[model samples]
Structures are given as C-alpha cells and as structure tokens.
Target: MKRIVAAAAAALVLAAVAACFVYWDTVRSWLPQEVAAVLGAETEDGGGERDRSAVAVRLAPVELATALDRFETSAEVTAAEAVEITSEVAGRVETVLVEDGQRLEKGAPVIRFDDASEQAAVNAARAALAEAEAALGRSQFLFEKGVATEARLETDRAARSTARAELEAAQARLEDRRVRAPFAGEVGFVAVDEGAYLSPGQEIVRLKTTDDLRLRFDLPLEVAEQAAGIGALRLVSGPEGCRQARLLTVSPLGDPTSRTRRFEAALPDGCDLTPGAFITVAAVTGRCPEAVFVPHKAVERRGFESFVFRAEETDAGLKARRTLVKTGVLTGRRIEIREGLDEGDRVVAEGLQKIEDGAAIRPAGEEARR
Candidate 1:
C-alpha cells in the first residue's frame, strides 16, 4: 500500500506542473509585447516603442464659395400693403360679396350691411326737407307781398337750411352700408357670412395686396455692418430660384439680447413666392482680398480652441505639426481661415485620429499637388 501511495503522489505533482506551464504561456500572449518584456518575457524591439504611419496631408484645389455678409434672421412673409374692411354701421351682414382667398379689384363690393334703417332714415330726411322748403317758399311769398314779418321769414330760412343738412347726413349714412374694397388685393379671413350680425367697426375681411410682397429677416451684428454697403438683398428659393429685392427698411435699433439687426426687402412685383415662405437671403457685407480657406472637417475643436495638422516632410520621415487656426465664416463644408496658416500650407482632411505631432505619415487617397 505504501509503495502505491508514493507513485500516485508523484503523478499528481507532474500534472500540476504541466497545468502551470500552459497557463503562463497563454497569459504571456495576451499581454502587450513591451509589457511582457518588462515582466521578463521574450519580445521584439528590446521592448522599445513601435513605429507606425499616420494620415498624410493633401493639397488640392478646393472650390470655395466666398461667404458674403448676410444677416441670418428669422422673418415672416408679409404683404407690401394691407387694408382692413370693416362694417361702418351696426347691422346684420345682409350679404358677403367675396369669400376668403378671393382676388378682388379696387372699389369692388366686399360686404353689404342691412340697408333698411339707412333707407328709412333717408326717406324721413327727404320728407323733412320737403316740409322745410315748403315753409320757406310760403314765408318768402308772404314777405314779398308784405303779409309776413322779416323775423318769421328768417326763422323759415334757418329751418330750410337745417333740413337740407339733415338730408345730406342721411345720404352719407346710406353710403356707409355698402362696404367697398379700399384697394386691389386678395381677401382673407372673411369671418362674417350673409345674415351675420356685425357691430360697427367689426372686421369684415382683410384685404392684402399680393402684387408686391415684403420679406423681413434678422441679421447678426457680425454681418449687419455689411448692410450699409449693400444696395439690395437677394433671396433664393430652396431649388436655387433667385429673386432680387430692394432694401425697403432696416431697424434703427439692434436687439439687446441677440445684438441682431432687422432688415426688410420689398419684392416690388410678387412672383411665385408667397407670403410666409422661408427663403435664403444673401447680402454682401465685406470682402477679404487675400484669404485661405480649407475643408471644415479638417479642423478639430478642443473647448473654445480650434486646431488642424500641417504635414511636414522632415529629414527623418513624413510627420505632422499641430497648428492652431482662427476660423471666420463657415459655408457648407469649407471654413475661412482668418489666421494661423499660410496660403500654401497643406492640411490633413481625413484619418485625423491616427495623426500625432511628429508621427510618420503616408498619403492614403489622392496625391497632394502643389
């Protein structure tokens, strides 16, 4: 029994030693080669840093759209002219001649108020005028024949004048019952229908001239300065439809919160553009005689600072230098470089993550042209 136990113990010790060898080999492969060498494992490069390649900078013709000074504003489309059609007298709206969205001509009848009261008043005034004239004639005949006193004749003349004035007032009141279009425009918000009661001064319809439209937009202070030099503003539709408009008005005061200025352009003749449609406005502010522009994606931001990498071919090899650039206006994918880089400098547009200062680089896509 003692001899058998001694043999089993020896076998168990050998198995444990074999298991430890396998574990150490697996663990060594999982570690970084440099770390493994430091920990007494065999690795290449004598555990030194490994050299790698980074993205090279490219120089090419980048078509840049010179960003003009424009006030980036929020404005609504408005009619160049608008008038409110209201009921002049209090009465039931007997008939509405036009509906909402109807194009109307100047002096067109828009609404008609109940004219019964006005007509009655007119008739009453006529009767009173006739009575007064009859009295005046009778007094004149009696006075000429010396049968009436001059004081009585004067009284009769005054009554005749009073009656005539009332007649004119009644006639004017009758005209007020018929509402006429003050100007040519499209009818809007026709709230009253036939037989709807409307008080005096109640809104009947809004007439807005669509022949000319006015668009208003706000511009930031940065671009608002250019407005003084610009004679007009240009607006373009989403599909590149262009329209030129005269500078109608601009706000004298700037917004305290946004420091933005308000500007308006008048479309003298309204085209396919309608009120309330959003369109882009371009106003040339100032020009930079010599400026360098680059692809916007090439610039990276860290906090408030922006930076880019310039490719340099050193004696050792190709590498990059971190450069800080001041950016101006950004249009589409390109940004205007206000400072930091010269016009001939090359910048990395892609694979920026793999680049570091003094890191070796090789061009990946297009070849850099001088």
Candidate 2:
C-alpha cells in the first residue's frame, strides 16, 4: 500500500514540473536578468533569451594614430579692459560729454558735474596766492634796499607757502566734480542726464575696450592642471575654421563655492566676436602618438562602468562581445580606449544600446570615419 502511494505522488510532481517548463519563456521574460537566467533564461542584458536576428549597426575600427587629446568647455568673450564709469564726488550733473557707444581715450572727460562753488573757491585761492607772491617779492626788494626787516620778509614767505597749499586744495576739489575715462574704451549707455544729482561712487556709464578682447572660462582643479601644458585654446564655433586663442593667465586662487579656477585667453586679432558673448573653447591637454581610439558613440555607460561592444566574426555571422574599457583623454569626436581594445579591432559605433553580449550584428559602415 505504501509503495503504491509513493508512485502516485511522484507522477503528480513530474506533471507539475512539465507544466512550468511549458510557460518558462513567457514567465521569465518579465523577470530580471539574474532571476530569469537562474530560472532558465540565457541572456546578459537583464532580460529573457536575446533575439538571434542581426541588428544593423555602424562599425568604427580602432586606430593607432596621433590625435589631439582635449578638454572642451564653454567660455565667455570679454573685453580685456571693462569698467563702469562712476562719480568720485557728490554733485548735480552739468553736462554729459560722451554719448552712447562713443569711444574715448584715457583722461577723456565723460561727464561733468555742477562745480560753480568749487570754481569760485579755486579762483579765490589763486588770487590769494598771487597776492602773497607779490607781497613776498616786494618784501625781498625792500630788504635788499634796507627798508624792510628780516622778520617781515620771513612772514611774507610763510604766507606765500600757505596760500600755495590752499590753491592746490581748491583745484583738486574742482577736478573731483569731473569724471574722466580711466582707460581707452568705448562707452556703453549714458546712465545720467543733465541736472540729475549723483552721489559719490554712483555709476555713470560702462566702458569696454573694442579691439582688446579676451576669453574667460573656468575649469575644475584636475582639468586645470592638465591645461597648464597647453599654449592656446581652440575656438569651437566661428565662421572661419577653429581659430586659436593665445592663452593669457589662470587665477592663482580658486573659487571655494564652485571649486574652479578662472582662466583667461587672448582672442586672435581681427576676430569679430562681441564682448559678453559666449563661445565654446577646447584646450589640448596632451597628445597620443600610438594610442587606440574609437568613435565617441562606440562607448556605452552602464552605471559607473563604461563598455564597448566589439564585433567579432563567427561561423554564423558577426556577434557582439560586450567589453569593459578603461578610458583616457577625449578629443572632439573620439575617445581614447586605454584598455579592453587593440588597434584594428572593430566596434559597433552606432546602435549600441539595442544589443547585448553575444547578440548578432550587421555592420553598415558606408561613410568614412574622419
């Protein structure tokens, strides 16, 4: 009786296992790759069995060549000398000497404030100085003629010195009411009109050098250290082919908030870039002579790991072998494959995400890779 019951239980267990096998494809298709693979699925992309049909993809061969290794970043076009004009003393505006967009040289007057009282004080001080000088001359002559005492001459001399000092003080006050350009530059909009009162340090107008232009940018600490070896920056966007800008300076101090260092480069002469306009810049960090590189699209990033699908020919056709790579410097359109690939190796540059490990592929490399 016991043997007969055990045989019936074995038959029921075999039937249940057969039923699960029939639905294995559909059930595991909805599960994660790890769970699905353990449960009879056979793929690496976290899915069910991968399709055997080939996916059309463009292939880029790895090359051992010399290429620029650059770090690309956006930079702002700026005038080498730029400042906003401001008043140094409080007064009512008398005249606006410069109009909007007018270019002025250093020491050129931009605006003048009301200086009637200052002018009067200057005139009075000048008259007192002249009077004191005349008295000293008279006293010197009289002393030579024995008609004036030494004490009298000395008193005249002291009075002349005092008067001279007073004149200088008055003139300096008068000049403070006039605003002059500190450097040669074109004026922006005139901020004040006639009869408008302005306080000390109030803005009058903006001045920016027209021809003297620079490119200003920021880079992180690591990239900045690499940029130290480069002599120039490439202007990525321009009518002419990538123009070179002369490297000027990098700030000694770094910004604590952004953790970046400021960099400035002198733009090439006759380059008609507007001030305050932004332009893209790329700086070469280093160059590789015999390094392996592939198209930028050939690499795929999964989480923190970067991968490339290398195309290998097999008896059936071409198959994709997903490879883990270590990357180096990146230029414009290509990235350095420091590891995981060799020269002349083929990689699926386009349609990287549609396939996984051991997936079939069709190479469609019609256009030449530059």
Candidate 3:
C-alpha cells in the first residue's frame, strides 16, 4: 500500500511540472522580442529609471502668430433709394418723353396727358371770375352812392369768392396733366406708349438711385454683437470686387426661426454694385497682436481643465511635464495659448497618449529645435 501511494504522488508532480512549462512557452511566443527584452531587463533591474525613457513623442516649438476671429456671411446689394414711378391721376397719355435707361433730374418731364378739355375749363372759369369782379366793383360803387342795399353788396362779394375758388381748381386740374419725375434717378422701363390710357396709381417706370448702395446681411446673434464694434466691413462681389462699407444700422430684434440678426451697411460711392447683387461680407471680430500658439494635438482636455505636455530639457534627457494651459480662440489646427506657455517653449505635439507627467521622451524629428 505505501509503494502504490508513492507512485501516485510522483505522477501528480510530473503532470504539474509539464503544465507550468507549456504555459511559459505560450507566453513567451505571444510577447514581442524587444518588449520581452525590455520587460526582462526591467524585472532584472527591479524596475528602475530606464522604463521612464521608453516613450517616443514628437515636439513642436510654440510660435508667435497672428490670430483673428472673423465672421463671414453672404449679403445682398441694394440701392440706397429705389421707387416705382406711377401716375397719380387717371388720364389719356398724349406723349411719353423719357426712354428706358434714361437718367433724369428731379421735376423732369416724363409724360404728358391730353389737356385740351382742362385748358378750356380754365379759360371759362377765368371769364366768370372777371365778370364777378366787375359786378362786385359796380355794386360797391352803388352802395357808397346810396343806390344799392347792404344785402346786394354782400351777394356780389360772395359771388366773387366762389368764382375765384373755381378758377384755382381749374388751374390745378390743368397742372395735374403733366407727369414729372419725383426724384433724380435712372429710369428702368417705360410701361406706356403714346396715347395709352392710364388709371391712377398705374406703374410708369422704376427709378433707382444707384450712386451709393446698401449692403444687407444676416449674422448669428452671438456674432452680431461683436460685429457692431467693427469700424468697417468688407463687401466682396464677383464682378464688383471688394469695397469697404460703414455700418448703418442693425435690426432691433432677432429672427426667431434662424436666430440671426439683420444688418445694413452703406457702401461708398462709385462702386458698380447694382441693386439685388449677391455679395460676401467679412468682418473681423477679434484680433491678437502677438498670440502664442501651438499645434492642436498638444492640448488634452480632462473634464473642464485643459493641459499640454511641455518638453523640458533635463540633465537626464528630454522630459514631458504636464502643464495647465488657458486657451483662447482655436483657429484651424492651431490653438491660442493664453497662459502657462510662452513663445519658443517646446511642447509635445504627437504621441502624448503614452506619456505622463515628468516622463522622459525621445523627440521624433527636427521639429523640436527652436
């Protein structure tokens, strides 16, 4: 019985030894050669400073650059003054004086109506007024000589007043037959020909004062407030090129659907921008004179706090020191470092995930040099 128990114990010990050797071989095959060597070295050396120098990263020097935050939006060009010409009185057109695309001064003759009947009425009213005046004069003379009563003299005076009012009305009717330009502008097109009958409020032509233009644009509510302080805005059009415009006014209310505000700017004179032209508006909202900037990859965010790995040179080697940074505007792939960084400071731009605070580093390329 003792001999049988000894043989079983020996078998169990040999089986456990075989299992341990198989596990060791599998683990060794899975590990990379260099990683295995490094692991073996660290284990042999009791995990010393050599493990800290294994991280490789790329570095970039902080640079002084101009940073601008701007708002770009599309706009439309409109004339400073534009109106549709229309007739105020119904009449038969006798003559059309102005042609299409004709520039005219204020009070220039545009159209004339047939005024023969109106002229005859004015003449008849003038004759009646003269007769009433003569009768009034005679009645006054008779009243002073005791030949006419006071009631007769009053009647004569009333007749003269009525005749005068009638004559004035007749003259006004004659004047309305001549249609003239209300303001100085270029005419668009004549809608009526010679002898064409027109009613009141009928469109004649469109007049536009194009010497100066109004640039209309919409901006986001947040950006609109910043744009208000800008001295001038740039208007860009394909055919008219770029021109400077001064802000005139902004809408008091914002659009609820788009959450944008409307703004109008007055363009300078002599620009070839016509009404309804499409344009691009550019306004600089903020600018930094000497902003310190670094590549965006260098910045890492942990919750609300932003930090970067600064490449600090030490007697041992290049070390990555975690630095808390205050950042401003982010333009493209670069970010503005407002605090905790200075120009010419080296920062780790790549391979930051494998590094920690005060970890030794090997720079990847020549970008580390100032």
Candidate 4:
C-alpha cells in the first residue's frame, strides 16, 4: 500500500513538469520576433541576463514651416450704411412709389405726397414776381427819363426782390413733398399707404446700403494689440468657406464692462451675404518664419509637462531618449515646438506608448531580427 501511494505521487509530479514546459513554449511562440531573437541569444550563451529588445517606433524629422499666429472670434454682419427713412414735412401720401425689398439708386423717388397746395402757392408767387419785375422796369425807365424819384425806383426794386424770395420758398416746399432715396440701397418695408396722412419726422421705410457689408467683432483687451498692424482679416461660415475682408476701423477705447475692443471689417463685394448674420473672424496677429513644428501625435503630456521621444544614434544602435518640450499654438494636426527641440531633430511620431526613456528603438522601415 505504501508503494502504491508513492507511485501516484510520482505520476502527479511528472504531469506537472510536462504542463509547465507546454505553457512556456506557447508563450515563447507568441513573443515578438525581435524579443525572441534576443532571448534565444542569451539562452544559447548560457546567460541569465534580462532581455534588451528595442521598442519599434516611427520617426519624423523636425522642419521649419510657416505658423499662422491668429485669433479667432465671433462677429456679426452689418450694412455699411443703414438708416430709417423719415418724412421731413407733413403731407398726405399721394403715391407709394417704392415697394418693400425694392432696390433703388441715389435720388430715385421713394414716396410722392399730394403737392396741389404747394404748386398753387408757387404759381401765385411767380405771378406776383412777374408783375413786380414789370413795375420795376417801368420805374427804371422813368428814372432814366428824369420823371421818377430815386426813392420810387428803389421801392420797386425791393418789391421785386421780395416776390422772388416768396417764389423760391414756395418751390422748396413743393420739392419737400417728394421723398427721394438718400443713397443707393435696398429698401425695407414701406410703413405708409397711399392717401395716409403722415406727420413730420415719421418713419416711412428702412434703407440699407449692403453692396459692401461690414463685420463687427469684439476682441479681448489682451489680444487687441496684436491686431493693430493686420492689413486684412478672414471670415468663415459653415459651408460658405472663407472670405477675405479689409479692416475698416477699430475702436480706440475698450469696453469697460466686457474688457473687449470693437473692430469693424468690410466684406468683399458680390458676396451673397446678408446683414445680421454671424460668422467666424480670424485675424492673423503675426507669423513665425522659422517655426519648428511636428506631428501632434509625437507629443505626450504627463500633467502639465509635455514630452517627446527623440531618436538618437549612438554606438550601441538607435535609442529613444525622452525629451521635455514646450508647445505653442496647435494648428490642425501639427503642433509648434517652441523649446527643447531644434530643426532636423528626429522624433518618434508613432508607437510612443511602447517606449521608455533611454530604450533601444528600431525605427520604421528598418529591418531587424535576422
């Protein structure tokens, strides 16, 4: 019975040894080719040294490129000139000359008021002036013939002058009855109908000169100084794309409440943009001629510190050295490396998670593990 128990224990020990061998062989087969080669070399040399397989990574060389230092903000569209058309004198509207949404040129008639009384006054004044002129001519003839006094001739001349002034006043009144456009623009809703009596200073319609639209935006006080010398600005809308605009004016003062400065820009002509639409404004503050940039994926951030793995060639082979970097503006997929990097330095762009400081690296497109 003791021999049977011993035999069972021996069988159990043999089965455990075979299971351990199978598990180790499966793990070795699953290892990366480069790691397996290193381990095989160490095992064949009868060494118990730790594996020194390099981490495979892709590299990108730093290059100088143009970096646009710009500030983006929201802007509102406005007309270059907008005003509410009002009546200068009280009169009854005779004709509604312009319809809503009608485009008109400068001096085009927009509204016509009843001018019968004004025209009658003008005609009466003209008739009185004609009679005064005839009388003045007769007085001058009598004076030349020595039959009229100088005082008499002066009285006739004064009467003629008064009549002429009356006629001029009447004509001005007649002209005021007809409302004309102040400038070239598209008219908004007409507020009065024909035969409607309007009082002086009453709003008649709205006029907006929108051939060239203006964009107004506010920038924070800190960034206001950067936009001082910018010659042009860019406006971006969803799907409409980007349009160039000229900087028209900037407010000399900042708003105390919002701590922002107001800026205005003129949009290009022939664009189908309407006033009151919101758009994105981008103002280029400055440019860096020799800015060093790299793929954004190359940067690794741990807390507030940014790091990049640099591929350095040495006597042993290519190795990845972790480098600390200061980053600037990020434009699209590229990032500006302001410090701790130089032009032409190689950095690991991909496979960064598998690497550590001072680890061996086999760069992309290079053969390893013969």
- For all predicted structures, in order, the TM-scores are 0.71, 0.68, 0.58, 0.60
Ranking by TM-score: 1, 2, 4, 3
- Rate residue 95 of model 2 by lDDT: 93
Clash pairs for candidate 1: 71-219, 73-218
lDDT by residue for model 2 over 74-173, one digit each (tens)? Answer: 8998898888878888889999899988989899998888999999999999999999999999999999999999999999999999999999999999
> What are the lDDT figures for the candidates, one per model?
0.75, 0.84, 0.84, 0.86
Give candidate 3 misplaced runs (Cα > 4 Å): 1-64, 210-212, 235-243, 269-273, 276-280, 288-370
Error of 4 at 76 (Å): 3.1
Instruction: Tell me how far the alpha carbon of residue 82 in candidate 1 is from the true structure, in angstroms, after superposition.
Output: 1.5
Once fitted onto the true fold, the runs of candidate 1 whose alpha carbons sit more than 4 angstroms away are: 1-50, 53-77, 87-89, 238-242, 270-273, 301-306, 311-324, 329-333, 355-370
Winner by TM-score: 1
Cα error, residue 365 of model 4, in Å, equals: 23
**Positional deviation of 153 in candidate 4, in angstroms?**
2.6
Candidate with better TM-score, 2 vs 3:
2
C-alpha root-mean-square deviation, each candidate: 9.8, 11.9, 12.0, 8.1
